[model samples]
Target: MSRTVTLALVDSAGTPLGALPSFGVPEPWWQEVGSIVDGARRRYGVEVSVLRLLTADRAAPPGGCVSYLAEVGAPPRVPLAPVTVDLAPQPRRAPWAQPGGPARSLAWAKRELDRLGRPVTGVNQQRSWNLSAIWRLDGPQGSAWLKQVPAFFRHEAAVLRWLATATPDLAPTLLAADDTGRILLDHIPGDDRYAADQAERAAIAADQHTVQRRAIGDADALVAAGVPDLRGPTLARWIRDRLAGHDTSVVADLLADLDARMDRVRACGLPDTLVHGDLHPGNVRGDGRSRTIIDWGDAFVGHPAFDILELTEGLDEIDTAPLVAAWAARWRAERPDSDPERAVDLLRPVAALRLAAVYAMFLANIEPSEHPYHRDDVPACLERAAGLA
Candidate 1:
């Protein structure tokens, strides 16, 4: 599938230039802007950085033809006429969505890297959106990552620090972090293990179980570390409130049974602990021997089963069973009294509710243009929950 992007070029001063012809690229994923940037550089012979999405055409959630208002780092060296187009300021803005936000983030990363004596030699913006802005910074030593998250996720730095202290190897090495949610991390040298074998998947699941086990009785400490308390009751309230305004008439019966199902999940005896809210194979990075989990923006304190559900999300029943068994075995060994198998069964609908609430939260906070990224997520998850009911 091919995806295209139309750029409304803007100078560093936020002055509108002209619109570039809509360019097509093989990679159709809309949110991943690395290809879009590379395409602009390759075809137009100009360096451009995407600031935020302006409007999407034929966009189906994650991919399609989209128009973005981008900042031009330098004038185009090649003589290619860009059509005259009016560039108006976007009414809705996230901090990183603002024209100056990317520059400021880059400045802070450079300053911090300089302080660490690892001045940047090159930069590559891998992703930019409302949730986070990520850049790969290269220096004499190696590549490091500079990630700036929104205010809602300002707690990520603290969460990483807590993880470092408690379970050192599970998270990335934090080089430097500030109050603005910008974090400099030492790059883990490996491809994301999205295609790990069944044995490897089992092993990774066990490792996360260990991490969650360490946080078993430290709910207050985890909260103090800036992790949100999405324990049973808290998440329940969020689900109810999130689904309140939406027309959930079709799932009305399922919604009514939500509380009882959640209570059964609680009764399964799995203690609430640090849940890796978006735990999946794609988020794990390693070179066969060692593995590390990345992206803690969705981390929360919730039932341990939620992590298992996340880990085995897209797997078939045969493949998912072994991973879940390995994860549950560790927990059952740790808490001999707990019934993890039962918890996994009971938490299916609850997990769906959690996903719905989270996507709803994303839609509420992000700019309108970016809303398409998660617009259908709430209803899709609710429908899944109803089906699972």
Candidate 2:
């Protein structure tokens, strides 16, 4: 289902003028707000861009995607209530969000934290994504991060709780999780370590290997907790389906290769384990003493090296060897009969393709303004995949 975004107009006096209820599907980013600004111009006689977006904690003011708060030049002439406006639909925002703003979301966050007995003495950072963003809430027990997820994103709290039973340090301790899918997690406090050497990253791969292998038996429980199985055929179909919408020859060649050799990708001799779908440096937090993995949103059940593949971002074929060895050693230690090199050989192309597809999909959906962020990099990623192929 496409996402709907609601808007709240703010008058010159800083008072809110209620939410703009009806909108087109797939809430757009900055560029897509022009129509909304025009709406305010036509109805309120003022051109506006002072848009502040937030997601309703629950069912959006009846049927809206999020409760957007826009700064209007003055109080709206119409009654301060939800208004409907038709728009040319554009695909963007995720399929979960409700009508609520910073105020409502913060109130809900404070309430949820209070219910969890974690008082918000201070807020470290403000939120962004409609109201479905994550924020660090300082509390009596150090600090905690309150994250609001979509109705369909599954409960990470349960997965965290389960992970805590074994490798408690591998994941954050769950503070509270409600039926609405808001998860309060203990914030790992410390300074961000900028540079991570191969050894430091190697330890992370090993840690991931251990945690994933231990959780293999409970795949059903983990998937039940919302983690997906993205290994083998699932990935093949996913890459194929996403690329089918594009007509570029670069993409066509990639698709052809995938279609022809996907069976080899499926037959890679590796044991399926808990996979952290994205394992780049930015996602891992280390304060010198320890490392904590963040953002399991892309996690799935897949090959072990796949979990650590993102770490090889800038490395050439030669540099990725040691990292692959470290990850494979852990897998080999667990399963003596498995051939790590063979598995790596088979998955190398698929992994590169997977990473390229990920970037390609992002490039396709993103706006021109967003292009700067990926212009040089995403194509480079595709080139790497093509080189591997």
Question: Largest TM-score belongs to which candidate?
Answer: 1
Clash counts per candidate, in order, are 0, 16
lDDT of 1 by residue, 1-389 (tens): 76778888877887777777779877666767888888888888778778887777764545677888788866566544465543455554666666667888899999988988898999998887878888999989788999988777787787788888889888899999998889999999888998888887887788888788888888788888788888776777778887777767767886677777778878878888888898888889998778989988888888889888988887899999888888878888887998999999888877987888888877777777788788888888889888887
Lowest summed lDDT across 10 adjacent residues in model 2 is found at: 93-102
lDDT of 2: 0.60
Off by over 4 Å in 1: 74-92
CA shift of 263, model 1, Å: 2.6
What TM-score should be assigned to candidate 2? Answer: 0.69
Please write out the lDDT profile of model 2 over residues 1-389, one tens digit for every residue: 34355566655444545665455534334223444545555555654433334444342223345445455545656555654422222354322222233344457778877876777887633333332456667867567776765443444556677778868887877777767657777778554333667787777777787788788787777767767666666777877665554433554565666644556644545666677777776667878788887766566766676766677767777778888887777767777777777766656667776766665666565433234334454455556666765
* Local distance difference test, each candidate: 0.81, 0.60
> Candidate 1 lDDT (Cα, whole model)?
0.81
Error of 2 at 102 (Å): 2.8
